[model samples]
Target: MTNDQRDPADRPRSWPYAAAAYVFAVVMVGTTLPTPLYGLYQEEIGFSSLMVTVIFAVYAAGVIAVLMVAGGVSDVLGRRPVLLAGLGCAAASALCFLFEGGLPLLFAGRVLSGFSAGLFTGTATVAVMELAPRHRRGRASFAATAANMLGLGCGPLLAGLLAQYAPWPLRLPYLVHLGLAAVATCLTLVLPETVRHAGPRPALRPRRPSVPAGTRSVFIPAALAAFAGFAMFGLFTSVAPSFMAQTLGVHNLAVSGLVVFLTFAASTVGQASLGGVPAERALPLGCFVLVAGLAAIGGSLLATSLALLVAGAVVAGVGQGLLFRAGLSAVSARAPADRRGETTSAFFVVAYLGISLPVVGVGALSLALGLRDAGLVFSACAMVLAGSIGIWLLRAVPRRPRPGA
Candidate 1:
């Protein structure tokens, strides 16, 4: 009997999409596990700030390369295989960190983590939604996104707390994640395959991101909003800790991690708050809120107020969440079923670019301009970009007629 023809009860334990999401979250936790430890790495390895961003940029490059080449592999090869491969990458990434000797290992771990995430991002999301009962598909989307953000948020918190108070700072976090990855691998093996295989596997190669021509109107705005929102995340992840340590005189590793956590936590809340709001409304509003958050963050930099920085992180995270979910939903809803994986991958390509490119600029600017001034410039540029997008969205999205008039 084919895998699909197997009895339902014979498959691994099922709970709508919970099993997939659990695996999803575990893998993602590994991706950002190094966030809080960059400072420690710097102390030990004696690298400049530019190297930090360069290391981070290498990870982004890996993600983009995978998305461009193998993003749709699950669509042909089946989700479970891709997921298992991703877990293998995660395991390898954890091992890299566990035995990291210097810059080479650090860079290898990050790029491996990127490859793992690139695989999981679109594949796991589609698997979750596909596995859910029809009625719960909407909730499944949220589940996938929440798992992504919450897992990303929790990594630093976990690492920060452990590194601050535990025995081994760098070694412990990856060790814990390695165990989690093992469990996720077992769970993924049992999870039923969502995509059916027909005959022999097709050769996978690099293919440009293609959205159905009809979906472009929806795809463009949503992708742009995602880019803007993720840029805020990239900034926080790459440089916020440094800002806290260097400028605000906050040296507590836990505090640094918490500040970053608050941003992603706020993003989760923002996404949940969208309940039934239309994308037309949510997208533009998200842009406006993001701009406000940027302005506040800029103000915090100028004033050197930690409170303001925390507040800005929270506000900006919320805005990022709002646009991220709304845009993802709009794009996923419009994408053709057969091409969902590639379309979703394309969307994430744009988002990851937003996260990587601007932050690299920040790192470069820090050399000539210093962290404070670099941050100020980034905030100003992002604010203008977000504000312009908001204005365009407002004009481009047609207003719905009043209920009766």
Candidate 2:
């Protein structure tokens, strides 16, 4: 068949999508660069555990704000512009950290990082998918997700090692990220615009979160699973370091970062492992695994055993990976094609809430009961929620894959 007559899916994809994935990774790296350094910030700045959670939550707030308000701006503004804007936010966030002014700058940096993340999360994923050759779309999707988790995983690892062994513990990691962001910016500039608008630019506006009437049943369980999984992530990123230093007496910054990275790495693996599990069974199974991981975490806290803590993180991370991907896939499948994007946004808002709100609660609990106790409470609560959601899914959803499968 002639080129015009051939299926568009058969068309060759350019290299820009790969470059776009790299850009996505770089921006995400900035979002969590400070994870391992939070303890350092606390010591140098003299903040309470509550303040640390607040700082981390501020980033999530920025992310949710942008996700709710301007999530779809790329469809209107074009992918390149939105991506560059995200990179700008990331650079600004890095600069905020590099300057080291105090609590205000830390908060500002995190919020800016959140804005960058919020902007990147939807836009970059779409950009990667849109730019890829139709045949390579599956790989593109995996690339987008892997970039996100791996980038997030790498941040703590990078920051921790640098801070622990290198000079300028607080400043160096951000500086390195700043250099990477500049490179990502150059890449974004060159990437072909994936959104092809014919006439004048449409006015950018907020898209309210919506769940179609038909998909509500699947949406709730999937969203809750995502919430539980992200809550685990939030716990690790925000407070795990403090727990390591104060309760465990494990002050090696690199090890702390390594533990967080292991969870994310496990999550990436879990996402990859999803193809093996029947789609119908993925969510419930993931929840059970997550509960087990959370239980291990709680045990680690009670015993102050670092080995068990790492084991729990890896297990929970895998569960999180499975729960997040499976829930997302099921929801997207069930959602009306026209409303799929809207539904996914709503799901993410819930997921980000899991990451932010619960961590803050842990922070509050820490003030009254202490960090170890706070963690145990958090883990037990997460386990219960995950377990409940898993059981419900098993009962309500069928044993076999639905129509889409």
Candidate 3:
């Protein structure tokens, strides 16, 4: 039989694809396991709310630093080595959290977690998508995105349960995560390496944030929408629990974790919906929906209503998920094969910036204006930013041309 017409069983198995997806999911979950536990840390360590934001920002800072220096290293060094290294970093981060007693260790743990996630974000997604069966690429894309959101959502939920119901609430969660990291590391070693390179590994060079020239025009508006969408996510994950407890009188950790999970779960749904829509169209629609969700969140903060907050979280989560997938598909489609890894990394750099910078602003505002008012201000600002970007994307992005037209 011709190569193209060979039996399906003759093709490489797809279990490795699923395994990579699971490993990346585990890594993403570890990054956010500390979310619900932040409250515990504040109480145990005797730090102010502002300090929580500072510590969270340290994670973002570490992610950006790594994205700049080593984001594209996997392209040259191969996906497995980078992924294994990232898992190692994650294991180290978990150990730091297990031993954490003060602000310094918290900062160090988050930075290490950020470093680990920065490594995994680009490499894992590419690995999964590349390994997918030709006919199942669309499903694979959703799987990759679902794994990300599911992992993130599970982190807080798992931590909250263990923290609230188990012995050694603060310590147990990290130990559990440490165990997962060990398993993930072993899985990484067994997975087949995707990148084929015959020469010695390239010397580590300083990473610079960049995308392919062909993708730049489309990348700009997509990145902007992602930035705003991820900022809303960052706020929810990092500070929303504090708002719920302090401003709304909801102090239950499980409930708080559920609230955060709902948002990310909605994002998975949103990303899945994009399978039926074109990326060019999905980009603007997702941004507009995201803006509306932000407005709802601001309204919820003003009214001090739990229902409103939950509704806003769901709406914003869906929008963020849709836009994130759109951005990923568009960039990946336009990028040249040789530079695909770097291009994907550049997109995530913008996405992570959204996760970091705006949340830090909210933290600063909380210090000056109080939590509820600060949330209102943060939501309003994000709405305005999202709305502006939506308009730009709608006007600037061209309709998708017919294949081979």
Query: What tens digits encode model 1's per-residue C-alpha lDDT throughout 125-175?
Result: 878777766556558778888898988998888888889989899899889
lDDT of 3 by residue, 280-375 (tens): 889889999898788888888888888988999999999998888898888888988767667777888888888888888888888899989988
Error of 2 at 27 (Å): 0.9
What does each candidate score in C-alpha RMSD?
Answer: 2.7, 3.7, 4.0
Predicted structure 2: lDDT:
0.89
Supply the TM-score for candidate 3: 0.92
Q: RMSD, model 3, all Cα superposed?
A: 4.0
Best by TM-score: 2
Poorest 10 consecutive residues by lDDT, candidate 1: 1-10
Arrange candidates by TM-score, descending.
2, 1, 3
Q: Whole-model Cα lDDT per candidate?
A: 0.86, 0.89, 0.84
Q: Which candidate leads the pack in lDDT? A: 2
Give the runs in model 2 whose Cα sits over 4 Å from its true position: 1-14, 198-200, 399-405
lDDT of 2 at 15: 72
Q: For every model shown, what is its TM-score relative to the native structure? A: 0.93, 0.94, 0.92
Where model 1 places Cα greater than 4 Å from the true spot, the runs are: 1-16, 133-135, 198-206, 400-405
Better of 1 and 2 by lDDT: 2
Residue 197 error for model 3, in Å? 2.0
lDDT of the structure predicted as candidate 1: 0.86
